[model samples]
Target: MSNAPSSPTGPVNRLAETTSPYLRQHAHNPVDWWPWCEEALALARETDRPILLSIGYSACHWCHVMAHESFEDPGTAELMNRLFVNIKVDREERPDLDKIYQTAHQLLAQRPGGWPLTVFLMPDDQKPFFAGTYFPREPRHGLPAFKQLMQGVERAYREQKTAIESQNESLMAALAELEPHASDALPERSAIDAALQQLDTSFDPEHGGFGDAPKFPHPTNLDLLLRHATDAPQTGAPDRSALAKAVWTLERMVRGGLTDQLGGGFYRYSVDALWMIPHFEKMLYDNGPLLALCCDAFAVTEDPVFRDAAVMTADWVLREMQSPEGGYWSSLDADSEGEEGKFYVWDREEIRALLAPAEYAPFAAVYRLDRPANCEGRWHLHGYRTPEAVAVDLGLEPARVQALLAAARATLYVARERRVRPGRDEKVLTAWNALMIKGLARAARTFDRPDYLESAEQALAFIRGTLWREGRLLATYKDGTAHLNAYLDDYANLLDALLELLQTRWSRADLDFALALAEVLLDQFEDPIGGGFWFTGRDHETLIHRTKPLGDEAIPSGNGVAALALERLGHLVGEPRYLAAAERTLKLAAESIRRMPYAHATLLFALDEWLDPPETLVIRAGDERLDAWRREAQRGYRPRRFVLGIPADESHLPGTLAAMAPGERPRIYRCSGTRCEPPTESLADVVKPTS
Candidate 1:
């Protein structure tokens, strides 16, 4: 795949009218692209031609490469159009399809799959026979040329029908076998311990991240570590190693090119282990959990690095990603002006030109502008030195150096804004929006930022007003139209976000909405017999396979989030069914978590909560003191405690909350699982650590 860009030279296709930004991106491709629809599938079956399915997202750099190289090439497009019924799908819009095909690709090729996934499927059964990602326009890197591969696929489909059928049957059987079965016994604490050990083994102590190059945010792992680290003191021994790993990685990420030094949002991932040189796409999903992590880190350590990181990220999200209609935008494209990172990278001369001598000296020293260009002969700003170190070198106070650097950053940001900005995917996806909402809510509560809370509430209102129709949710909303059956992630993440939002600020309406979504999860997504949630809802479009994913992926697993949310909600509302479902899900996922603990970090969290239920705190107050009391209760980073501040006059409470009636004076009622403590008026007594 090449970073070089070329103009598309084709008439518009059916994808021009699609809601998905990714699908619309390929509207002008020379290949006769049909948006994944029943009509297109029927056309393939009627013609008895195999379907050529291309799955990718708008911000994916390789997807753009493949579009420019093959989909836009008239000759290559002609071959594709002639031999097969071509269909284009936005993975964000139809993750169910992406999940199925990507898994199929892995099964067939025995390798990991990525975006720009190309697959050849029998139109009748929609079963894939061949799969790979990013086929070259010309044969290179052991991949067949687009035209040659297409012709061969067509020939094989025609000549080897019986063998293909047999393979399809085997693939179907294998896919079915992947579904996790319910375990007779509950997962023990050993699984959690083993996961921590695995993380310790993979942790790059020198660099502060897991594995080698190509470091993803992996917010779930960080969250797990943070929770474990917080729990260490109660065990009579402090596990500083876990906290160090999480903090160091976060610090490195904030300083490195993975974070936009001027813009304040994180990029998709770091291409190098040092967290420098990122794959420039800015995703809402990545930033949300990251924002929460930064907030938690700040709360845990009182580190200015984390506090500053959280503030900047929250500001960026509110400034750029939030839509006029209140929902968060999906992502920012990696490429702008036909070149990757062109909008973000800068020349040393540009920095010098933009700043005064005093400003330039501090800025250059801190951002490594004095060093050799690290990103394609241009600098992508990363912290190479501290302000204090630079101050020492320049014989200036740290405060003075900080002032100069801040001024320079502001000046450079104004100049950078003049350049062609990256394209923003304006589609408001329910799941992604929920993730952002959770991040915003967590940051709001941690930092005492009402604006962040307001932003989160607005996004939640947008989802509730627009995405929620009748009783179900529409997955994505664009151009005043909301459509598509919501996935498990949508329901699960939204439920989780609502839980977070409730803790930050009490909302009876939001609670009702949360309960409704929870019901949808059980009714539409849960696999009652198997004991976990399916990726697609029961009423969703029937694909070849129904996936009950347990492990975390680019986002946390829906099952993991569902289990965690249900467990918390069940405990909060005193709902037996919710608790039972959560337990069943743990039983289903226990084997997977025990086998590959690191991969199942999110599920492990649910397991952790199951083994030791979270403390539920209900604060009842009539006046302004409610906020103060709640804030005081949240003095430190207590991950295992859920604090809800409800008005004294508030009526129609849930069973658990209703049991603790509000008194004339503010009171706090605490509960762990089914065990409850007597209501207390003193906030300090509730927050104080037990001896």
Candidate 2:
């Protein structure tokens, strides 16, 4: 069985005994790959053959161009090692084997395919029929060549094996059916006014993102269009607004090129639809939900351009994806030198050979770069020019032409940090470091920034001293170990980043490690008789489908953000079993939120907190004037609400909270459920009842 010459020539069996550096970067390829378990599906059902698989990740740039053109050639690894039984997996460590091979390559490429996918299957039980992605080892770009598409899928699995298993069992039974709903359920304010009339029929109001040309930043459909424009006049629908088209598509995606205006996050999408060019991968879960949608558009329009794009995406996640044992590094590479927007496109004569020619036409007319048509001819993006078009081309004073294009974009972000950058993927993960510790502790209480709350307490002390362990919660670290198996979106996004760092550092050991990892995510990813939350973990090693992770793809649904972090840790600790496991995981996706309510906008922000449950702002005494009155009560636009800060020797305040006793220099305690109020020691008495 050792065959020894299984292609890319030698070593790497059992993915060199795992711990995935993308399955040890296909440990010496030569095609006899394997690594997707059950002993590679019992050696492809004992050599009846046809498995193949593939999938990808490890900062996928065409999964390193189909692993350096045809899994490192050697005659396309001896015709994929004498026809199929390959395997390989790593879609970020089995996102349920990349959701059943990307739903069988969108039902065999009916359209929709990405990554280095590939596919094929059949080995008696593995299933899939055929899929596709990168091909070309000879036949030019129009596709079809990996050795005549592996000798015509090994002569149609040895002469049309039952018409390719009856066309992949009728396309996996028409993709496991499921749609049919309408027995009239609506009311949740007519299913949020038919999801704001399907976001005003996929709003793109002349370029600001919704649909049209590859754009992405859905940020949970701009957080369900700012919670249905602040819950539409208490549901009577006063002038149906979708929060001014979700703040003009988040201020034109922070002035386009899908944001990265000289570094400071964003860009996992925007292949043109006015967000201009992009596809330059940045990720860490798209800068923790675009820095919590630029701190909820700077708390509903205090918009200093969404507070300087949420303080330059929390200072580019503390200067380039944090982690010096602080945690946060998952992605960056959208190819660096090997092309793809090579260190972020430039051209216009390399900004006229780095400025001077009298500051290259006012830094190329304040960034829209005078001419070179969008990308390809270079100058990818830089739109919102006005500061009176950089004060009529830098004669100055539109706030000094916006402080000289912010000091020439800080000297071209220090000469694009001396070039060759990209390639980060250091991999920490635990659900993208609990979504950048709840977007750097909610952008350090809105934005006062004690260095974004000490970079969210050194990423919650490097996810409680290196990805916790033994008592579980590991999910992925890298180099210094902490291998896989953690999913359920890494314990519901690290217990909602330790309940938003115990609501701004109240830290009774970060609310006892977010109530002991929310009872280890209700004893390992719940779903008792199917409710929700099962991206694997009922004693691990189980497959052939246990999935359950609701919807929302590019982030959201670790069972809809663990049912809104168990309804805000069951109102911060008065746990009714964390609000009955967030009402039985939103009644098992109440019919996939009435058939795709914009792919469950964070389960409609936890079903608008089980239908209206916000308003809880208890701040006791953690000082810096109760941290500047809890950063001016999180700068407004409440969205229901919950803001506990308790710290004068903490004594109970989490059984659905309601206790506040400090008042000599640090106070403020507003509540909702278990009601309570009166206790304010200024920050203008806690913004005099919500301003």
Predicted candidate 2 versus true structure: per-residue lDDT over 275-350, tens digit per residue: 8777887888878877877887777778687888888888988987887788877777777766787788777776
Q: Write the per-residue lDDT of candidate 1 for residues 140-215, one digit (tens) a residue.
A: 9898898898999999999999999999999999888877888987788888888889989999987778999989
Candidate 2 whole-model C-alpha lDDT, 0 to 1: 0.73
**Which stretches of model 1 miss by more than 4 angstroms?**
1-10, 689-691
TM-score of each: 0.98, 0.36
